[model samples]
Target: MISLIAADEVPQPAYSSGVMLLIAAVAVGALLFLIMKVKLHAFVALVLISLLTAIAAGIPLGDIPAAMAEGFNTTLGSVALLVGFGVMLGRLLEVSGGAQILADTLVTRFGEKRAPLALGVAALLFGIPIFFDAGLVVFLPIILTVARRFGGSVLLYALPAAGAFAAMHAMIPPHPGPVAAAEALKGNIGLTLVVGLPLAVITWYVGSYLVSQFLGKRFHVDVPDVLFGEVNDGNDEDEKAVLRQPSFAVVLMLLLLPFALIASNTVVATLGASGAIDAEAGWAEFLVLIGQTPVALLLTVLASVAVLVRPGRMAEAQSLMDGALGPICAIILITGAGGMFGGVLRASGIGAAMTESLGDLGLPLLLQAFVIATALRVAQGSATVALTTTAGLIAAAAAEANLSDLRLVLLVIAIAAGSTVLSHVNDSGFWLVSRFFQMDEKTTLKTWTVMETTIGLTAFALAAVLWPLG
Candidate 1:
């Protein structure tokens, strides 16, 4: 005879014990050292480490491949479409002269005296819709032009722009890194935006000001020949070649539309869940459906075409599309690989094991999120990798802890802050800044690297303070 029991009373499988947790921690640390110190590609390094983690946990070898496959597919399925669309949209903005228009208008409005602040604002706005590399290339020419005309240190303008762009690229959603983190953590996109935007603003201000003050004194140095050759002095030919700037309204509208849609969807979903909206029959379902993607890319492209494609600019569109793909491809691949890593960790039960162990320590989830993200960022140079990896680890913990949506969103921002800190030789952004601004390694380290670290640290500090309020 069998006895019936309450559904909630059913026994669940036991998690890894404390000893297994310690082993997992050691494995994670070893993986980081091998990748960072030994110089392995993170994709290969993470997979190898994950397999070792499973084996050390006494999981059978035959199951490793299955775990990896699950991890790869799950992450790709969630993010692939959004990434592809984002790339295409960024290409449109670049080709359409939208970024150029915004830069030109800001520089003109601010003049040389205040150009640094203006450039920083332009970058903060422009970077939201475009990739960092694309923004760099699109605007670097202008930075050179401004420096030549104004006689100020290139760092004054360049660092502000780079800081702003990096801040937004790392923190904003609809960009692959933050979006992936948010998805993995099941975070509320609206709250992430609200929390991240202020942090981004503060980061840009502090980073730009410091870069200007410190590096502005070193303006006497010669511009590198490579960048010097590309500088234009605004001749008639140069003026003729200049694309017409897109209207500020059009550009701002395109950039904000997707964010608005996503935010609306999140708000609706939250309200519906809380019974603030009628769930059985209301606008909430539609909002949730539309919010599942970054539909704003489509609107952005259309706005670009409407505002930028005057008679002869069709060729420019094709050129922009071709150019944008090359830089974006690397980020896409890295993000996909990160997804695979996260999946493998989950399938192998490593994420769960790590979470269980960490939970026993009684650390607040917010602090744990930031620390993991920062450690990974410091270990590997990629913010996306750090955000995605941290999100995966946090997801495992969130499942056990039953963390709220608001807290999860805060965790995503905290991870973003971590992934953003400490740019150096290993980071591509460092090279981009060094080359574009004609700065030597020392200057680049002093200005660009420090500025990035400032942005990261500032943003993280803000997130830390806000975590409790949430």
Candidate 2:
């Protein structure tokens, strides 16, 4: 049957555990069909599916909208503010030629022979605050310019740079995937950022950078001239280039500001928990307050305006920040809807049933997180959706597990790793890389697909290894 009696009418769902599990499976299958075959917008599809699933699960008809709103509002409360501030910070850096400055300086330091390495490193630094798509698009011209200058496979320059953004975007907070996962799992955002930063860099090096070297030699694809043809590579004398680039120091400071602030908060909280310091003390409380993730990002955005924006350029700066928010509106809404779906699943008792089933199967929570996330990711695309949905699915189990904050953070990373693997035609990123590099689908699969899998596997392995320690 499509629905049982409402919870108000009947104290319990009419279906047995096996039937409820089947309903959950059908709901997920229906969602995949709606998104993949019907070509529905994810936001609309998620919201529609959430309502249907709620109805099927026997939630009272009058309570359905509030349940949806509760999920949506809870996610947005943690998500929307951070995303808005993060994009604003990213936009400030992008418009002010911060990416160019960082790239130019890194290339100069790393030398021409190691240009690819330099590009990758620069991308790692620049990608911290930006979304994957925005970061990739912003770095495109630089990647192309370097590829043309050195005259080798575009994969050499592109893969590492692209992979850096992918790593940071998938694993780290303030980026929607990790941020939403952290929120859904009730992980500490500060610790997520602190732990994720170094892990992303290490995984990117092992999975992406080294892989690019072999792939570069194997595939000798040329740079595409479609986007920015024959551009001067950061030439100060180019009359057409008007914006004076910010110094490397300014850019570096902006990038590090949030990390520093958030880390301080995490450290103090950790110390207090360990009985090393009085967390309730006024001094410690003050540090913790400033170190809060949203507060730190907000402070970083304000600092960017103060330090990066020159006198009388306030209007221009405002415009740049305004432009950044427009693209991310869809992302924010879709994420909230994903949360709504998760909420419905939890309220419908599917989460408890799945937890019990997984336990009977003897799967570890860490492994369960990765496997479920991977299934969702492969069935649909969009890492953010996979991350949020998986977090929601496991939230009940995770809460009951009563993991420490560290374990929760590690769990978030595991979920992120699962969402990242197996990008193919269904993933927009696969197409983005394909078209940007002018590679055919086959080549994209061999290069982008393989590299993404490696990155995901590497990250998951790291998280799993650390799970016991946490």
C-alpha lDDT of all candidate models, in order: 0.60, 0.73
- When summed lDDT is taken over every stretch of 10 residues in candidate 2, the lowest stretch is 1-10
**Every model's TM-score:** 0.56, 0.61
Worst 10 residues of 1 by lDDT: 1-10
Estimate, for each residue in 285-309, the C-alpha lDDT of model 2 and write its tens digit.
Answer: 9988987767887898888888766
Error of 2 at 365 (Å): 10
176-225: candidate 1 lDDT, tens digit per residue: 67777887777777677776787778877875566555666765444432
User: Clashing residue pairs in candidate 2, if any?
Assistant: none
The Cα error of candidate 1 at residue 124, in Å, is 1.1
Clashing pairs in 1: 71-343
Models, CA RMSD each: 9.3, 8.4
